[model samples]
Target: MATYLITGATGGIGEAICRRLAPLHSLILVARDQAKLDALALTLGGSHHAWATDMGQDGAIDAFTARMESEQVTLDGVVLMPPQPHADDNPMPTPDVWRHLFQVSFIGPLALLKGAVARMNPDPAEGRRAKIVIISGISSAQVLSHYATANVIRTAWVGEAKTLAFALGSRGIHVNTLSLGGTLSPWYRDKLEERAQKNGISFQAQLTIETDNVPLRKYGEPAEVAIVVEGLLSQFSDHMTGLNILHDGGFTRAY
Candidate 1:
């Protein structure tokens, strides 16, 4: 069985992807929270394993690579799912914060993909191609002022994925990013509640206003996002590389 490496596997979308993929493939779940990872591993079945690592920390990629090597793990695919949202009263976008966001959104994914792509052995005997899937935000296009750092960093990640797709296509490695819109996950619900409280509006009122803005008139479910991720990782999407698949329910106006 092919092994898939997933970062930020404790978060909403990430956890959804893990649950969706774990039954079919062996999963290596990476996150900072060991307890959460362990719990998720047990719930997802015994085929899933957890690796505790802070993806935001320096040298983390190298350390993770070493661990995988020691365990004789060769990854056939990777899912990059690092978190990027900031609640109220967090630090502003200073140079240090920008650097950290860029590293998490851009640098870290690149490093993980580099390692996974290097280790992938897509022989005819293996019967599968290697893939790299990144979970980014719609802010790459929508210039949300509150998420300026995410806008800048996710754009960079998209650009980098394009280049890597071209560079690795000849080796049968696919690279693509999924730009997500509003998904009704626990983290998003918490964020909405927090924003509503700050704005002096009821949570239902806030949802009503936001849904009115969406062309689909609803927030996407975590399973919807998971379906998109699965499609990107599937053989049917092998011909597609370096593309950004937007899952925003037609909320973005830009062509």
Candidate 2:
């Protein structure tokens, strides 16, 4: 069975991915909450290890990679799900906020991916080329003035992943980013609830407006996104790389 590392493993979409792949893949769950990770590991009923570390902290990614190295864990794939940026109406947040978001979302994932690439590409005989799936927001391509950090850094990450895809191809590693939008997860539920309360509109009303904008006319489920992640991690996508896939229910029309 292939082994995969999933960062932000306790989040809504992360949890769904774990559930979807638990039967097939060996997972290394990384999250900020030890209790939640432990609970998930138990629920998954597999030989999985849970690592609790704050990605926002300096050297945290390095420490996790080192631990995996010391334990002689070879990963076949990695799914990076950074902390979701809270929607801030500000077009530009304070410099400190931007820095914090960049560190937590972009820099930390870059460090983890760098470390994993070294370990995952040591030998061609071990398995298929290492697969990397970066779960980023739709703001990576679409303009979201409110989510400044996500709009900027996540977009940068798409370019970064494309570069890595080319650089790592000869080493048998593939990299791709998933630009997701309007998924029906806990994170969005809370954000929508807050917006509804603030606007004095019903939650369903707000949801309708958002969903109506999409060609699908509905919000995507976490499981729907998980299926795409599974494909990226599997041999089904061996020929695909350097792709910034839009999982936005036809919300983004850019060609």
Candidate 3:
């Protein structure tokens, strides 16, 4: 069985990804909370490993990469899910905000990818398969003034993924980005509740307002997103690379 490293593995969608991939792949769960990681590893009931590290910390990513390399571990795949920002209702973007965004969204994931990709077979003739799936937000493609930091960093991250796809494709690695719409996960539940409270409306009312923006007229479920993620990580997408798939329920009319 292939081994996959998943960052932010404790979050809603992250945990969904873990559940979807657990039966087949050996997981290396990376998250900020050690207790949560331990809980998830136990729930998964597998020989999975858990690494507790905060991506926002300066040396954390470096340490993770170094440890994996020194252990001579080979990663067949990597699933990246950056931690969700807390109540990004602020219109003004600060330097600290940008720094944190870049740290979790771009820098840390990039470092991990470098290490994971290095462990993959470089010889195409060897037929050793490898995949990298990145979960980004709709802000990557659409403009959300409140999510300015995310918009900038996510776009940059997608660009880097494309570059890496080309850099690694010939060596038998595929890299892709899944730009998502609002999913009714724990992260969005908190965000929606905050927005509703701010707007002096009920949670369900706020949910309706948000879903009205989507052509599908509803929020996506975690399992729905997980299925697509599974496809990207599996052999089904062997011919695909450098693709940015928008899984936003037609919220953005960007054809």
Candidate number of the best TM-score: 2
Off by over 4 Å in 3: 84-92, 194-205
Q: Model 3: per-residue lDDT, tens digit, 1-255?
A: 889888878888889999999998899999989999999999998789998977766588778878887878888888888665744656567888777777876777677677677776635576678899988888888787777667777788789889989988877889999998888789679888999999999999998998897888888888898899899988788899999899988998987
- Error (Å) of candidate 2 at residue 65 is 1.7
Estimate TM-scores for all models: 0.90, 0.92, 0.90
Predicted candidate 2 versus true structure: per-residue lDDT over 1-255, tens digit per residue: 889999888888999999999998899999989999999999999799999977777678779878989999888999988775667667667999878878887787788777777678435466567899999888988897677666887888899999989998877788899998888889789988999999899999988887888998888899999999999988788788999999998999888
lDDT of candidate 3 vs native? 0.84
Q: After superposition, how far is residue 53 of candidate 1 from its true place, in Å?
A: 1.2
Q: With candidate 2 superimposed using the best TM-score fit, by how many Å does residue 13's alpha carbon deviate from the native?
A: 0.3
Task: State each model's CA lDDT, in order.
Answer: 0.81, 0.86, 0.84
- For model 2, where is the 10-residue window of minimal lDDT? 119-128
Model 2 TM-score (2 dp): 0.92
